[model samples]
Target: MSKSNRNLFFSLYWLFFLVGISTVLVGQVLPILARRFSISDSESGYFFIAHFAGSLSGIFLYNYQAQKSNFIRTILLGICASATGILLLNADSQVICTIGFFLNGICAGANIPAVNMLVAKLSSLRVSSSLQVLNFFWGVGAISSQPFFHALSSDGSVLLPTVLLAGAYLIAFVFIYSHRLEEKTEESSRVNRASFWTVWRNPIAWITALFNFAHVGLESGIGGWLTTYSERFAKEGLISATPVFFVFFVLGRAIAPAIIDFFDDNSFIFLSLLVLLVGLVVIVFSSSYVGLICGAGICGIGTSAIFPANMARFAKIFYPDASKHATPIFVMGSFGGAITTYSIGYLSDYFNSLKVGIFVLFANTLILIALQMLVLLGLQFPKKDKT
Candidate 1:
């Protein structure tokens, strides 16, 4: 990569790192949030709903915004929006925090896909590998947020963490906005300009989005609920376990750049689903703390490859039209996370056990695996040499 591309890479990577934190932030803090807000499980579901709704809207809005603004300005706008959300998130008022979350949603909806588009367009590496690198940073951010905050404030000082995260975005915004981006290729620009309805109307695009939906549901559902599950069913140090799960997640994605060399992307996804199923089984049945942690860690590794690999495949298969597919897939991912986050809360409350909610990850895994098969079958499950 040239200096400019490298700059874009680091900037985009860090943006996602914060995004990962925001994505998992709710679940990590749910225990504290419940106490601080005097919130019930049903009401808690709204938090996920609000954030994902913002994210979904942001994805489409970004599709629109990308036309008028350059990437740097789009990113700066997203960071500013996100920063506002974080600051409000720290406010003492419930009403303020509620608006904060909606703003956070808009921030995520706008930022995640927008930064990602820059990374995809700017990568010096293979698109598959570059995306893996991006998401690996995301896992790093996701895993680190819980423990970092827990270390900073065990009593649920939401302000400190939110402020810190918001600061990161602001700093990143400065770095990216100042860098001069290379002119976009005409082909890339044309593809990016594809009508939203055109992509929405395609079966492949819907199928692609569903894969992301199920994948995000599993990733967010597992990441969000694991600590709570461990707290209720296993032990008290669930906060510490957050990083342990993501260590394996990062490990999986770190190695994903090379996995493409050994197997087709869809084949890797198929195997990953099996791995995830095993991890889910371990999590569901494991009666001991050690067993639970180990299972959760395995689950992380299983999920690590899904988002990036699927995304790379989408871009590759669709080729020039890849730009059109980006927004909805991102929206579906946010939707998946929202629904899964809500489902876990609802199921856990209904059963009066976190374990029941944990089981939802298993169901999502199955759905994602089925989607992977559809992709494979649609493409006739390409041969080894073909990969």
Candidate 2:
């Protein structure tokens, strides 16, 4: 790779790392915020809604604007927005904090797709392996957040860490923005890619969207609520159990490249989904602390490779048209995450048990497994895409 591309890769990885922290931060502190605002579980669900709704809006906005511009500008602007959102979290009002999460979602919606597309372009030949490695950095940031939040929030206030994190985002923004990296003429614009309507017509598109909806929602629901769930039944503190989940999550992604080398993308994802199912089942039924921790770790491992692997498949399956299709897929994912996360909260409130709420995800995982099968079958009978 050229020096410029290498630098671009570094910047993109850092951005992914920051995004990982930001995305997980809300979930990590949701319980504290609920107590602070005196909100019920269902009411607290709005935080997820606000963030996800903002994410959907950001995806649409980025897609519309990206057609006329390059990615670097959108990325830098998204990072700035992320920093602003983090700072907003330090506010005393629940309404302001909700808005803060909403803004953070928008930042994620914009940045995730943009960065993924850029990295795909840069590593055309090694898309799967490269993406797996790139996402491993994301896992690193995610795993770090558990202890980071735990240590920083010892006084039962997350304000200090949020402030420090926001500052870090600002520093990253200046550093990435000042770094000169140019897009290739052909890659600079989205004009050559398939239109949204064109990509929308394909069966594979719907399959991809559905899988994203369920899978993203399941992952978010689990990650967002696991801490609270564990707190009720397990002997550990609020943050202790959550780290085990992310540790295996990080480990799974870290080793995915080698795993994919031994298995095809579809096969690897299939096995991973099965593992995820086992993990979810363990969490839903287990009463012991050890079982809960083991289940969380299994879940982390199960979810680790699905997203990046699916993305790599999407790009390969659609090839020349993949870039344009990403926005819709990601938008669906954001929607899924928002609805699913909120649904878990709402269900928990209704049933008066977090375990019952988690059953929602368990059911959704079954649906996701079916969707993966369809994707696998679709791959065997590849059709000429009319778009």
- Report the number of the highest-lDDT candidate: 2
Question: Which residues of candidate 1, in runs, are more than 4 Å off?
Answer: 67-69, 180-202, 381-387
Query: Each model's C-alpha lDDT?
Result: 0.75, 0.80
lDDT of 1 by residue, 1-387 (tens): 578767777777888888878767767777777788888776777877877777777777776765543556566777777789878866667777766777777767787677666666665247777778888898888878778677666565677777788888888887787674554423335535555555567677778789888888787777777766667774555445567789899899888887667888778889988888988898889878777788878888888888777777666655555654577788788988988989988987898876787777878888887877787777453333332
- TM-score for every candidate vs. truth? 0.90, 0.93
Q: What would the per-residue lDDT of candidate 2 be over residues 351-376, giving only the tens digit for each residue?
A: 89877888889777998889888867
Candidate achieving the largest TM-score: 2
lDDT of 1: 0.75
